[model samples]
Target chain A: MKLRTAFFLNTNKMKFITLIVIITFNTILHSQSQTGLVQYGHKQSMGMGAPIGIDYNANLIFDNENSLYTFAKDSLEGGHIRESVYIEKDKDNFFVNSKITNKLGFQYYVDKENKKLLSRDIGFNYVKEEIPTINWEISDEKKDIGSFECLKASTEFRGRTYTAWFTTSIPLPYGPWKLQGLPGLILEAYDTNKEIYFYFKSIKYPMDSKIKIQKPNSESENKEWITFSEYKKTLINKHKKAIENGRMLIEGFDSADTAEDKYTMGNSYIEIFDNE
Target chain B: MKKILFILLCSFVSFGFTNERIEPISENESAEITLPVKVETYNFPYENGTITLTIFDNGICEQGTVTGTLSTHCDDDGIADYVWSGTICREHIDALIMQFNASC
Candidate 1:
């Protein structure tokens, strides 16, 4: 007891903050206030134009007022595919593997009651922004997916036109990977170009005690939250660097004509264009 | 990448003729130069595999697990030797070089 007290005294403020987080975490786990959790299979095209796209698992965990959109556990391990362009001294034909390297490391935390959206991107930068509105064209076309009747809805989001199937039976607007504002729980989604696909895999009506929805960096003092403008600026700078590196790699290659192709290069991203 | 790895392995597995040079000297000089060298391979490691490096007195440095091997001079500078690390999509690409206890 004396040793524990000494340790706490040595790092008083940090320990106190950690203690609060621990208590809150335990309470969230044990309490009956949580709602549901769902898993989705996310498919993305390999950049080098390989037919077999990489697959990932994403999760949507929700309570009464908040939801967390993030990657599922162990999903990213086998999902990574890197494109390596090897240029030989004499051989001009360079082999470009159908390696898709675009993956989002951003986690979205939505505050429904407060109408605020918080996200942590690139593992460190915490950004707060208003939720972008998606103008969905809901149609009466209906289909049954896993015993749930779903309606077809299409929306042009960020540069991709996506068709989503949401079931009104659940009466929840939660969905995977920021595809939200639905009339009900989204079960499946796919882009028009077939480059991106998301499908509902499983769900727990009441989230398991072991399952957790992470609180944003605002809960911790070590992280200082930034605005979306700041986050966008940082991303633009990173994007420029990546383009520069790609150009350098392509400069000496004989097959320079195909240098800008996404399959031979990994410059393509999920958001083809994002004005906001 | 595959061809490079195959060629490296082939060169290393050559019967007795590698692309390395070593000239024999007199018996008296050889006797004075003979010394016991011990090396233990430690993996600093990555999620995909281990980042292991083992160096010899004859300027032969072999990297295990991942793909690397270069002829370089060395001395055992312990675990905290010059760390060369980068990221393979936000995750660390941890690489370490183990310096040997002998000079080339």
Candidate 2:
């Protein structure tokens, strides 16, 4: 075909052949999607003293076109931060992770074909926006976790610097929580200060149940979806109200107290940036 | 119902229920919330949520813990919400009030 000139070839026939090839390629890519379930143990530290944090489970079910990160249950008990230490704080204390991700009926869904993300925030606020870009710098460093060889990559999202360990063995971009757009499956991820961390616990790849990608809808949660920025503004207003109310509620939690300066919106949220 | 409310309101006005949030003395960090009355006044730097250490006009001390993010102010709920664990105690009830006022 390259040797022959455009005039020598039948132009109508050539265009038809090209269209067939394009359709075939798209069909092959779509057929190659492997649906599976991944379980991740999430740990978020409440950095008042030593390493004390809340631990919980986040499950991700993904195939080709969509991925949904969901949680089975929520815990308020002082979770194990490391091997021994646990959040001795009252079970009622709202941990940062749950506050950001798992509010009421917290369902995080990603539509890859259209490139959009949908999630729920506190106060029954919904978030549906274009998928934000995560510029990950993959390093040459590699290690073995379980049986698969994992590679290291780092990216700064929201406000915290996160390091992720992914394995191409799975060959999917889905991970625990909101971390996605990777070339492979992210098995583990942690922030720079070790305040937040996620690691692979177990998996049931190629799940038996037919994987159906369903967006969080009114049938489940009766609410209208808003942009991510609007959802954040609501939280900012709540925190500001809390600050104002704090002055009248407790005597010590003021400008001079440790809880005042450190307890800003930036530090309290999983997504540190309010604009997101 | 109105009669009981009137009496309660009158009693509260007469007693001047003063609520404060403070930590216990250095010697009593993990002490039980209910201690013997002879200890005078004690504070609890609540471990998990907001707490209230209230002293009535007659010098009876009572502490209450309420669990909620909104309760952190310890304001309307009369609870103290400071995740920070520090209980600096000034033993005497009257003296604790003076020291608390001076520092704030």
Candidate 3:
């Protein structure tokens, strides 16, 4: 009878152990199911890192000696802006290609390969230009960005402020736009609104083929290198006549048959294109 | 044998109670969650229409259908008045607060 009692107690202990093991396993499974699964390359491939719906408002104030001044507010409604970014990396150098679209259906492709930057205006035809090189000062601030550690950096080029955040965690110095020169990958960068904003969307590590840095096309060869300020001046001069024609068309001058009819048009055009 | 059976029954009861009586963790105990969302009210000019949006927290957003006269505003007139209805998730209250602060 004592032996039988001993056997029964041992069986009970075994059953208790089995139940505890099962409970622990169930709890672990439940916790694992609740955890989020992260996709590493999804944002990179879709180019979704660009901040959507960024509203830009600029107030232009003109002051005269007579204290007569006028202020005009220009606001840009937010929309989905698409940018195409391409990156390739080798042992010593990196290549980056970025394309930004404008309202006039023109696309600007800024290519940086082998520490050289080329800016190309891509329309129905390509107008490529070489940009003057500017030196960058690497910063030391560490930023945690979506499972990557990025370092903050800055550069000043021709009255524009260029801030860059790069991550050495990815081992590729390539980033969006012409921003580069880090140990890892660039996450977010901008030139203070006057230029451009290149936000880190994703990083791709290709499995095959070495990255080859391609030279700019022959048409872009031997072009005069200009500062960003000079480029802006040239762009304004090129689009000045077109902007005037657009203003006239928007004013309904083409539809008016008489001068008085045109004169009766309200000052809405003044609010629209007062930048000129 | 009777003692063994009684012990097994007691263990089963204890297990059942532990499973059924487990309490959920309160929101205060959890980490802070911030979601980015936007809501806008628009009144169409010339036409009598209104657009109202309520974005949810889980990113499963819903847009209230637009209704009213289809007129495009050429002048700087006030938007038309229309009614829109939609339910937003409870967790999106923080997102609404952030958006309000940004706009203000």
Candidate 4:
């Protein structure tokens, strides 16, 4: 009878140990999957002097080594505004490709260890760019974004003067789109002209989400590998060629030639073209 | 037993909540529009007719009229009234109108 009681107690102890093990495993799995959502606003000229702005909710899928940034479908007003500008996922391979004609959404993959950045452009070109080191002039200006007290900083990048507000409390050197290299997460960034802006909406940390950082190799289309500088050169060439052909592709006017009336807006690049 | 079956039915019904289908333009068809108020016409599955939406650059809808056996039931049931006459943001409104114009 004593042996039988010992055996029963031992079985209960093993069951308790197994339950603890299962709970611990679940906690680890949950911690590994974290996603942060940033609602960003993009303002650009759909036509000359016709600036339009739209709000985009994007996700920053974080892992130990890397993060994936992509736009979430607009959830406002029952998604009344369809996601016209977005990356198309190749169904067969699940590789996301940019729409070349519009060049709407670009993808960036950052390697934290090596500080290397890989960006895929509209024409399916993979540009390996070194993460730009910005010399930000931190200012005494202070403001509150949500509950965090953010500090003001300014820097010039790619011919555009940008003013950024960052919060060191987050401790993650990240930002919306390709804007990073700050001491902390960039809460807001915009050009002097306000032509480009990324404003923080909200953040959800310790989230239960998994982000599969997709590899660009799954693409069926021939991946054109180029540096960021080379890709810029190609982009400039494409725009110039389009202008030289005596026609420009306007947003709404498909196949309708409005070049005579200047209905097709020229490239409103924030950085003025310099001879240098 | 009846209560259990009813609860199961409610759970199944709750699972049916999904985004309303907004079909995109066809391959051969272009989604471009002429400035002021011109758009290519197409059919929406929910609506019984070919819908043509006219809007300004600012996203103000002047028209969201339909022809041939039109029904407003699908849109009336939801927050999709902006498709008809309300001033919606033009960026998504253009695409939404274009999608409504396209038939799945």
Most accurate candidate by lDDT: 2
* Colliding residue pairs in candidate 3: A172-A184, A187-A200, B43-B79
Candidate order by decreasing lDDT = 2, 1, 4, 3
Separate clash counts for every candidate: 7, 8, 3, 1
Q: Which segments of model 4 are wrong by more than 4 Å? A: A1-35, A45-51, A54-56, A71-104, A215-220, A246-276, B1-104
Indicate the residue-level lDDT of A267 in model 4.
29
Compared with the true structure, all predictions reach lDDT values of 0.51, 0.55, 0.34, 0.47
Each model's fraction of native contacts: 0.00, 0.05, 0.00, 0.00
Model 2, span B57-96: residue lDDT tens: 2233233221222122222111122222222221222232
> TM-scores across all candidates?
0.55, 0.60, 0.33, 0.51
Question: Just chain B of model 1: what TM-score?
Answer: 0.24
Error of model 3, residue B40, in angstroms:
35
Model 2 global lDDT (CA atoms, 0 to 1): 0.55
How big a share of the true inter-chain contacts is recovered in candidate 4?
Answer: 0.00
RMSD of each: 18.1, 11.8, 31.5, 18.6
Judge the docking of candidate 4 as incorrect, acceptable, medium or high. incorrect
What are the per-candidate TM-scores when only chain A is compared?
0.69, 0.73, 0.41, 0.65
lDDT of 2 by residue, A1-276 (tens): 664765556686788899999999987655544678787777766342223464567777888788887652333123312121223345333222222222333568888888998875445557888887899999999988667799999999977788999999988887777888789988888887666778788777766665776777744666677888787677666666545444432342211122333355543446665442
Select the stronger candidate by DockQ from 3 and 4. Answer: 4
* Candidate order by decreasing TM-score: 2, 1, 4, 3
lDDT-best of 3 and 4: 4
